[model samples]
Target: MKTDVLIAGAGPVGLTMASELSRYGLSVRLVDKNTQRTDKSKAIVLWARTLELINRMSPNCADRFIETGLKTESVNILSGSEHIGHADMKEVDSKYKFVVMIPQSDTERLLEEHLATFNIKAERQTELTDFKETSDGVTYVLKHADGSEETAEASWLIGADGAHSIVRHKLNKEFHGSTLLSDWMLADIYLTGVQGTPAINIYWHADGILALFPLQGTRHRIIANVGESSGPIGEGNRPAPTVEDIQRVLDTRGPGGIKAEDSVWRSNFSINERKVDDYRSGRVFVAGDAAHVHSPAGGQGMNTGMQDAFNLTWKLALVSRGICQPEPLLSSYSAERSPVAKVLLEFTGRATEAALLRGGVKQSIRNHVASLVLGFAPVTHTMANLLSEISIGYSDSPLNAHTQHPRHGVKPGKRALIRENEPPVGFGDAPRFALFAESNNLPSALLLKYSALLEATPRAPLSPDSLSLVRPDGYVALATKSGDWNAVDAYLNQFLPKAS
Candidate 1:
């Protein structure tokens, strides 16, 4: 069967991509080699930015996620008995200001249920064995469980298939970077001595870093750096850590008095920071671990991948519908997202390195400096916003356009925060730019001419006599004064043909 988009790997990223395309009234078939969704709570914690983006897709979407997840407002860091630093999510400048602690399992389940609203289900045990990208479309070879192969054609192909992506391999793209030297351990268990508030508690010990992430009532996820590795830990090669193994780390690094029991999931892992140079090649693209993987320092791995889906799917939808030209719209995907990935990699790498520091002098200095710096409210607020990903934007994107007389508040490539009861820019079945200007000052001819590419009516302006054109993904594309209708026309005209 032919489809508009064929998604490989029904993980969170692929599911998100398919859900978005389907939401935009596009045909999508999601396929996975695995027969069923993961039962383990692998990647946990959806930050504020993710929830905000999901809410833009549908009013009830983010609400559903909030219902199933536990909310934590602050992350406290301690060194030995001394309080080092803390990140207070309450300081984040967003409506959903806290981190939502939900397992990757529940995330996928809820996403699948959401996809069911579109009458779509992921085909199980079906894998993309091979494919070729032609000028017209992508031809994919699907291998079934019983070894039967069927060929299908699709207008586009997305590989969310994971780190060992066949699509990336077929494209001959290099996954550059290195594996971190330290071995890590992750445990999901029920704890007894978690006191006071259920905040994320992290202890930076001289030995290693031990982090406790609250999942549910009395249930927490424990992750720690366990020193140098003999070699890379392979899947299922290393046995699960026993209760005593976790207790030892807790007794040595924890803030004292926490007892562990009722172990749910435990495994040993090594951190690897690898990413491809580009996200798109011809009609094929990759997201999630397939495109980038990094140290789980700030829990940004899955969130970043999912945002990649959010970023690309909107542009792809617009281009596929012939509303926007392919050159800048499609090309901007890599230009915009690749830099974000690079920044994330550097941040996570430094975090992991600091956490794994073995030298006593360096560790002491780090702890002392951290305490002094993070004690400031502004520093903590910045950390909170960065961790929540509310501060990320395509500041250098090719799509960003600015006028000489730019407005003061909203700049190009920055997020345009929408208020309550108002529809967000790019919210609906089709992707369209929202023009924010005074109703009288809005150029009626421009709106009439580019009705297919713009909002039906101008929304209330942020500043009087100022005009802002926001993209589908909520980033400001053009910011200029009200009289600069010519600039706005030029910005929109790039996405259309010269003859038009």
Candidate 2:
């Protein structure tokens, strides 16, 4: 078999990788060892940024997701009977302000549906047993359930497999991080008497953290820290919690009058904060849990991985089409994403530590500080933006360039807004950079020179005296003054294919 890209794992992250590649007109083969998609609701929140990327791929598909998933607008934090703080997601600077509460199972289902529009289907029960890389491409073998082995070749291999990724192990990358000592329990159950509007309810009791994420209908996902681990982390010798255990934790930690029953899924697991040194090694690369794993405190585990797929797919598509040089385009993937994973790890670790604080005096101080800090509008708005992930940018990215003079509105390496009536940067079969400038002419000769890699017509600038080059993923690549064609040319030349 032959393909442009071979993706391992059929989970949400892998599905995202495959879907984006397919949408970009790349030939992708998605495979997984599991016979069926996940039925369990593991990772459940779709942040604003993730939804924005999905909409960039297909607006109608995103509409379906919104219709099926519940929209949560705020998060309420409490300490026993005392209310600590509330984060209003309405302040997020995007058209879609609320977090979409959809199950991972639902996410996979929808992504698979989207991929079908491109006539691509995941080959289930097919596992990547081994692989090797050559001078220009990669050779891989897939083992079917019947024990038959099929050999294939591809230009690139993506490892979006889960934490115990066979591809990561084969690449000899060390998943460097520590296993958190506390044991956590997650329960997806039907509940009654949920207080307030549909919002995330967090209780920082003296015992530990109890978080309630609202799901579709009466369903809710309850996750809590069950104190120190008595046994080893991996084997999970600890038994699954019952409805009574869930009730006990809620009664002790959450506000009164809520009841949980009719359990759907319940399991105990330990948190691990680990990531590889790089996201890519030659023709092979890792995304999702294969690249990083951290605490699920902010529900960013899946969103970050999906965004990883978003970041890599466009560059892969552009390079595969010979529209951009491979070195800087591909190398920037690790440079831009590695730091993001590190920041996420540290942020989640701090949140987990804060929730686990013990002793009366320390707990009181923590509650007081949280209340006072979150009371301010700027504090709440910033926290809301962080949680929604709309504030993520690549200002430090190697791909970003600047002019001598600064411009207003969106800065280079930051996110540039897409007008409500305008198509997104990467809307067509190929990924093309959008040029925003005050001048209407924009030297059509220059655009024609790189038509395959750039949009044909220049878009009206959002601000006067500003010219911006926006990446396919909707981030500003170059922000300069009007008619700074030299700056734009230099930036594109870095990734543009060299002249023959």
Predicted model with the maximum TM-score? 2
Residue 207 accuracy (lDDT) in model 2: 88
Candidate 1 residue lDDT tens string, 254-344: 9889999989999988888999999999999999999999898889998999999999998889888877778788989889888988999
Runs of candidate 2 exceeding 4 Å displacement = none
Candidate RMSDs in order: 1.4, 1.2
Candidate 1 residue 132 Cα shift, in angstroms, is: 0.6
Poorest 10 consecutive residues of model 2 by lDDT?
A: 402-411
Clashing pairs for predicted structure model 2, backbone only: none
How many clashing residue pairs, candidate 2?
Answer: 0
Candidate 2 residue lDDT tens string, 1-500: 57999999999989999989998888999999999999999999998888888888786457778888999999888886788998898999888889899998999999999889899999999999999998888999999999999998999999998999999999999999999888999899999988778999899998899999999889999999897877876627478999999999988988878899799999988989999989999999999999999898889999999999999999999998888889798999999999999999999999899989989899899999999999999999999989988889998998888667555557778889868888878887788899988765577768877788888888888688888889999999888888888887787878888887
Given candidate 2, what's the lDDT at residue 169? 99
If scored against the real structure, what TM-score would every candidate get? 0.97, 0.98
Segments of candidate 1 deviating more than 4 angstroms: 232-237, 497-500
